[model samples]
Target: MKNTIAERIQDFLKQFPPFSMLSKEELLKVAGQIRVLYLEKGAYVFEQDEKCHDEFYIVREGAVGLYRNSENSQNLVDICDAGDLFGLRIMIIKKNYRMAALASQESIVYAIPSSVFKPFIDENKEVNTFLLETFATHARNYYTETEKGKRIDNTISIDTAKDLSTLRTISYRKKPLTCTADAIVKDIAMEMNARKADAIIVVDEQKFPIGILTDSDLRAKVATGLFSATAVVTEVMTAPVKTYAKKITVAEAQIALIKNNISHLCITKDGTRNSKTVGVFSNHDLLVSFGNNPSILIKEIKRVKKIQRLRYIRKQVERLLTTYLEQDIPTMHILNLISEINDALVIRTIELSLEEMPSQPTVAFNFLVLGSQGRREQLLMTDQDNAIVFEDVEEAMYDETQTYFLELARIVTKNLHAIGFEYCPAEMMASNPRWCMSLSKWEEQFRTWMTTPSEESTLLSSIFFDFQSVYGDADMSNQLSDVVFDGVNKSKRFLGLLGVSALQKPSPLGFFKQFLVEQNGEHKDTFDIKTRAMMVLIDGARILALYHNLKGINNTLLRYEKLASLEPNNKELFESCAKAFRVLLKFRARQGILHKDSGRFIQLNTLSKNDKLKLKRCFKPIRDIQEVLRIRFQLKTFM
Candidate 1:
């Protein structure tokens, strides 16, 4: 069944994203599944909100204009030239098209079946990134300012029959960490951690694969502060693990992850649960096949010398983030991992900057990461919020010390800007002279803010309070935390003000049992996820942590968990907050990733009913916690 026409199509695809990311063999496999269609000039490909087609289109000849029909006006927001991909929204998010695709001229396009492409996205992240970026670009272009929903869908889970299949087989890891079926889930999870493995297979006495437990499972159960880790392995494991022959085609492994809604598959000697385990196939293994690995990324980051190269690595991290999200890794873990990567990039940038300096630093200095970066909650590219803290010296040396670090901060911020972190619009960055100062000055500034809490002070508290040292003196960070804790303890009014700030955003739900969406301005008629849902959770967590004199826990979800432990009387409420925060973080991340934006806001109309319900379920705690804060802090005056 060799098709010469498909071969030509593959030749064209090899020059594009996702296709260029794939090997020659994999490219042809995708090409074979593509159904070539010719469109006369000005022909329609898909209409707005029509039930999604099973295939996504890529233009081969001519052009396509993705247009939205609103208020009886069809506005062409984006045009697709040859090789541009269109009509992928249906595949992602499993929703209908938000925009209609029309041939701008006579065109020939390759309709790649979603079935064939979905597996690739799960296995090859570059392909996944390509699809997501495409959807995000379209969403940002059209959906951001509009009430239009159904703009995009998730790229994974598309099912199309394979026609041009590659002979590629996914090689599973041999001797995967396994435990007896009766083993305690806590013990099993411990074994997994000890082995540095994210998954563990449960086997029968006969050494047959009976169940598989993955990181995602551990996250859904253990991380929520729900199930006891002491539960039996069977309690959390996906029972009757999908077993395949020791040698499984890449296509088969992918289909299994999708069909079973599972991340790990057991490869057994006889391709059945009755047989012995031979290896384990996981999404991580698939991603590694495409040359994406954290260890490798670290290596690349270290060796990269150019600012542009660091930018490139940061881009790779985006693709990596998409992979982790697709695998349903806990958002907290994803945040931590990506934060480490960001820290590394910043550290490397510092090294490069210092290497370029005329002389080494005369005294000790530390780099401070403020805001979301400071809290390790940052998952998307954001404005740089950082400062420089240098050692105190003699008055003569103070100016010299300031000059040296100022020059250093300028270089670091410049390099970081080049690396894709935009300059702080408010000039909160370290390069600003007011923020770049000796450690003693930072203490003075923090003390002033805490003692004299105001609207501006409260604003600064949200950013500066979460300072974590990315590089330099760890003891300085400890000292900073001590200052913050001492100030909050001494100023009870400050804590009350903080509590009021936490409750600033009212309950997410309105009187009509509908989401209280934004009514006007830039994000009109949309759900302000950050200002409404997530910030309420974050603010509540922050103020509670302040009240408890808790230090070192900055992430909102983790803070709630800490609150739960500290206030066992309200454990149920705190746990609900933690879970709600987790869901909101994931929701924002998906919206952000799909739109290539901050993911802080979302259009209500764009979400599915199930998604809406999931969101609504999280709001009860907002009301409950605000009540607790209101009574505890006597916030009637603030309200």
Candidate 2:
């Protein structure tokens, strides 16, 4: 037989998982021996309680449903789609199959003998780690009996910045078991023991830290007769406790601890010894905060004097995101926390760009983040779509002012690229001359798009209309928004144009509930989840929210919630649309985290039957919403 089959197997295998970690020769070897099995729809590959097979299967076509058989019922546990591997839990655990695999449709599966895959697993560290993590996450879900996949280990990376603004900064003992200057050494020791503290802070009546007495102080001073047991605490205590600000970073705390040769650093409001004591940072506290913390990273970004340092910090944020997703933290919290860090990075980029300018900005300016960043839902590093709005300048100065902001935008966008946000392919970013403009120019631009409402103008409006102030003057953004709403109010044609744009893509599923997977390009046969499912919800929400004159809220989910309140008759549909948006977003984030890309493409065969059913459920509202848009806006007349 030709090696075409084996090569095809390798091509599919190289795209996923532990198999991707395998070398070409090794992968080919496994592929060559792969036993191709064909099964009719509803045919069983293995049953629960049956002894394990020597090989595990990867779907070549169609789908397989994995069902867990309990005493009374068989529950669908997972669905394996094309390119998804299954029947391996038995191989991993050396036990009988606890779940039964049945062909969900007429399917082709390539069974690679476990013996062939085992050698690679043993030799490749990444392969081993992937298997361990995947198995652990799956096992955690099973044991918890919850859909939440795995509890992420928080200490692994630094980006775990949950909404720090919301989290109460942990309070610590500020006075710190202090004793007066006249207190006896024995009294200090007793006080330390009473408080169960390793050390005690010595202070004057004003509650300011003066010195510290530790277990070592008693051991070296009183125990060795360097001081009598009856001596005053001042005679034994080490003078001047190290101090820091309440906003001290974990790294700064580490450096302070190392530099001072001290265990605790007194925390004050102003970060100096002169301020009133707010709290204390012990070595233990330093260790605790050193783990994944978004606040620490944000603090680091503010201190970074160079673009390269900011770039390094951004990478740490990405690593943190990977860990966060792996842990399955609440998706909303993850989104909020990451958005803050991203905002901080953008702000830092702007600050750095200003420092490099020939002179300060000619006028007040505001940087506007459009699209996903505006929505505060960007998880992965996507394109940077932004604009600039400088203060209204005299007609004579307008061109120069626009040039100045455009130059600034170029620098900021460049730094953003250095830190991993891909440059927008369509040149939609602030660096683009078309997007960078003075306040009046931007207002005019928005007015034209809103009034004319051509295909290009509608597309531009779809993206730019969601602009949120990222940095600089807020009034400029306010004026722009006012102009947009005014123009939108005057033009039914514009709203209709937007409605047609939202309905550009058809529903993601066919009548039989099969995914309309891509038919061409590098991602052929893989479903483009973003264009097919996610964009539908995002575009629909934007159109409806703008049509309703909803302002401030750009998030698709929140927009839909607002829409629900505005139109009570359609509340259920709007609510379902919101829920569907969240579900699709979570799915895309999980899939993106899994594959390390945009999570746009999904292998339909890889989804479990339940997941497919859940995804299909989202389309009902999508179809209904499109119909509403068509009827209300009379979009068909425009078509």
Best by lDDT: 1
Relative to the true structure, how large is the alpha-carbon lDDT of every model?
0.78, 0.77
Encode model 2's per-residue lDDT on 191-258: one tens digit a residue. 77787777777776676777778777788789998899999888888877777777654444544564
Error of 2 at 325 (Å): 3.4
Clashes of 1: 6
TM-score of each: 0.59, 0.61
lDDT of 1: 0.78
TM-score of 1: 0.59
Instruction: Report the number of the highest-TM-score candidate.
Output: 2
lDDT of 2: 0.77
Clashes of each: 6, 7
Stretches of candidate 2 exceeding 4 Å from the true structure: 1-287, 326-328, 605-610
